[model samples]
Target: MAEMKSGYIDYKGFKTYYEIYGERKDNGKKPLLILHGGPGDTHLYLLNYRDMADLYDRQIIFYDQIGCGKSNIPHQEDDFYDYDLWINEFFTVRDALGLDDFHLFGNSWGGMLATMCMLRDDTGVASMVVNGSPYNCQTWLSEANRLILYLPEEMQKAIAEAEAAGGDYSTPEREAAYMEYYRRHVVGCDPWPDFVQEAFKPENVGECFNVMQGASEFVMTGKMKDFNVLDQVKNLKVPTMLLSGTNDEATPFLIKEAYDAMPAGTEWVLVQGAAHIGNATHAKEYFEAVENFIERHE
Candidate 1:
């Protein structure tokens, strides 16, 4: 394993922590800039993706978005956590690192952010890979409701009762029901991995998740409830690929909808038996698909 280089960059009066794995050699292929999910998820779970640096000789960069992970948290004002702030933060990090060419990879909410970045400007982005991203909130919620029906009857009842009571699904029973749904649709791994566990820690559960994503996956009581970029994706001219798991909350059906809205020639891949975080649960397959797409465009 290559030595990891970690540091922080000042972006608009906030500090953003980032780590770099593998050196950027004159390998022709550009470095990969990875955007993690959650408006609040740390780059910890995405550490698995650093394998791309080792296997494919690509420099892989992972960063904690402002107000999450090791980065400095700003005041949670009404105007603080919007799409433009994150998009600017991304370009700030890119410019600070002096990356002239790079491939963008974003998971879940991060995927939406990456798409917005491309839609804003593709001047430096060489290609993109969006994993389990939701382009339309209504489609996402509708699919989630469909999947919820497959849960055990008792679990379904518990979830319904909890959501009906103003999203207070924090009881032990409710937690158990949520986990049952998670094990099936969020992560297919039997025993959840440590990195995944770390993201959900009390201190690690940054305000962004609650403020941007709400209490649970199925519930949407946050500012991001109306976030939909389907109309803008058609203008994205960069070479892009979409990925989703067969059992993902961002189902293949939803991913296909986003793919259909993208400019023609965008690629799509669906991993079997994997859930939301396929890059973690199905690293080999995920990396192969990602590497192939990047190489084709390179």
Candidate 2:
């Protein structure tokens, strides 16, 4: 039987909650740490990954980053919610866990943060899995706009009108439009898994997202308006794998851009018929791909 433990860490005055499944003892395989999306989606949705320990025999770790889930959210200026802060937080988690070497799985915003962390330090990471994420917000926004065109005419018109009227993404019409896009390109699953639903809770939509990534997935009027690391990713030599859905908001083509920019041997997995959050609906395929990639790299 795998062991399970949970705890909190004092990270720069805030409490960051983490959970570990499987023993961390020398088991020939390195542990895996997961980073969930939304910048505030907590680690609940990703709890599905616990099976990695049971099925693959590798330790699995999950942490609800500060400002979400069980972690304490600090009341600071909007400026506090930036890549530098999140990057430092990532290192703190690693240091606290004593994870000298491990695999990483990052979804959506988490994937972007993982890429950023890799750019800062790749020596200790055996390999990384970036899921439904982008390296550039500008490109992501552009792609989202393109995807918006495929929505119904009413949705397209509502989106255009909302943007023209100061980008009100909260209107009922606007929200419906967003949901239509989400249903088709985000989760794509009829009844969202409970974990995915947990990620959509109000508290999960915290300042990190509000200040850093704007109100909607399709907009970019936040501090990360110019976030882009495509130019520098070529410097990374880490064995990496990029995972995306066939119809993900992250887009297969954009994922290809990052793949092309990575080291020569970087891997890519495209989940057929899945959307943004493949793990939410296609766990068997998504988790296996991750397991296979990490197993080989490890």
- Give me the candidate number with maximum TM-score: 1
lDDT of 2 by residue, 1-298 (tens): 5788999988768888999999876667899999988776788877788988888888999988787788848567886677787788889999999988899989988999998999898768999999988887888899999999998899999888877876687789987887788788887876788987977788665667777777677788888889788888888777889999998999888898888888888889999988987877788998899999998877
Where's the lowest-lDDT run of ten residues in candidate 2?
A: 203-212
Clash statistics: count for each candidate:
0, 0
Error of 2 at 224 (Å): 1.2
Clashing pairs in 2: none
Q: What is the per-residue lDDT of model 1 for residues 2-74, given as tens digits with 9 covering 90 to 100?
A: 6699999998787999999999888788999999988988888778889888898889999999988888485
Q: Judge candidate 1 at residue 284 and give its lDDT.
A: 98
lDDT value for model 2? 0.85
Model 2 misplaced regions, further than 4 Å: 1-3, 164-172
lDDT per model, in order?
0.87, 0.85
